[model samples]
Target: MSRRTPYFFLLPAIVFLAWFMVVPALQIFYYSFLNYSVFSASTFVGMENYRRLFADVNFWWTLLNSFLFILVTPVLMFLSLVLALCVRNLQRGTKLFRTFYFLPVITPIVIAGIIWRWIFAEDTGIANYFLSLLSIPNVHWLTEYPTTIISIMLVTIWRGAGYYMMIFLAGLALIPKEVEEASLIDGATIFQQTFHILIPLLKPTLIFIFVISSTAAIKIFTEIYIMIPGAPMANKALVSFLYQQAFERFDLGYGSAVGVVLFLITLSFSYVNIKLIEQRG
Candidate 1:
């Protein structure tokens, strides 16, 4: 019950986090300056890895693709907010709709990505099968760069929508009913109520989603890895670049450089998330 007792209780978690997270993060920065693999002795290379990375044509392209992934944030926000509104206005089956949409959120990402890869298969996949019925030819869903990124983005959106929708639903619930009723009495149209009233009140919720979702977009790895498993050259993104260099190629120093960059990029967004949460008061 003493103030010091609270610190004693928290000590274990603090120690665990520092050892696991902080130590590895520091190691990554330290190792990035070295030129070595797992088997070889590390030699301090003085930013040689970064110089090479910057010189690599694929690195710039990969960086662009990583930013491209940020597009998912706005798309997710729109879909989730719209779905939240729809569910809120429904007369019944609210639980059913919520459950159904949220089902994908519970499914394991690797398993879902594997199923989606099959569904998007060029010739015999269900996605193409449906398109066939509509007289649309099979479009290469996962093969080409453009479609590959788009397919991954779609999967991200589908998997994320239900969760964000629930958050929006919570935000909607917090709004006072009297404000809505007052708006209705003022003869505001649905569009007017949404743009003028609901959106303004939901600014905090929207920004919260934006920060978290943007962070996720930056760290995108699993979906691209799963979908493009066989095609290493085509897999161009910050994390993908890191994986290929560090794990696949066994160039630990080069890989650590990519990791450092990825860490910095994700760290900035994480800082924003923390700041937003603090200011949320």
Candidate 2:
């Protein structure tokens, strides 16, 4: 293909990205250097925004949350792989199973938020109700600090793992039958075959899942927003905290600064991930 052909094909995306993404991102960067409120005039403030962000206790927690979210990827990956294997091995109604697995992925986030909110409701929720079944007292899943984060993580894993599983299912299905047969002929156990053969071959899929899930975790918002309003979980994610500062607290300037920092951190993360993957490849 000619060099111009690729650009021609990409021209529309490039135009849309420049207008919507690049321009707005650059504007955020510009605003990060200003003391601009949502309603008031923005004054040039140099790097004061960044400085304040470093000193803000809540911002530090939010940053820590971002790292924790990234760290959750391995668990997510393991869950997805197990799910993909189970679904792949099903003999009857494979399509039905696939659809069931993908249902959460395609479900509206609003609906997920509503469902999880009900499930973890402080007093009337099913989770606590079930805990009460085991003679355990009702614990406020969404209100308690440490438990709140864990609850959100649990929800995150439940809502997201299936989507990654579908991706993994596709990758698993792509493996040549002969490869598995050869491994079987060599008397490899299921674990050995999967670990020594399948996983190495599935590296590309794993990498895709890792990067995408890590980014998704880092940008988590709506789940926390809908489920843990006015509670500790509100501060569980940097993006959510950024939203609080920007919209709720009406510190648009500071919020913009937070956004800028999040953008930088996320970009740096993706860049490093790509570089490491390239080196390994």
Tell me, what's the RMSD of every candidate?
2.0, 2.7
lDDT of 2 by residue, 1-281 (tens): 88789899999999999999999988988888888776888899898988988888888888887777777789989999998888777898878877776788888877888898899897899998999899999887888776777777887787788889989988998999999999999999989998999999898789888888888888988877788777663357899888888888787778888888888877977897788689776
- Could you tell me how far off, in angstroms, the CA of residue 191 lies in candidate 2 after the best superposition? 2.0
lDDT of 1 by residue, 15-41 (tens): 999999989989999899999898988
Question: What TM-score would each prediction reach against the true structure?
Answer: 0.93, 0.90
Off by over 4 Å in 2: 1-13, 232-234
lDDT of 2 at 177: 97
Highest lDDT, which number? 1
What TM-score would you give candidate 1 relative to the actual structure? Answer: 0.93
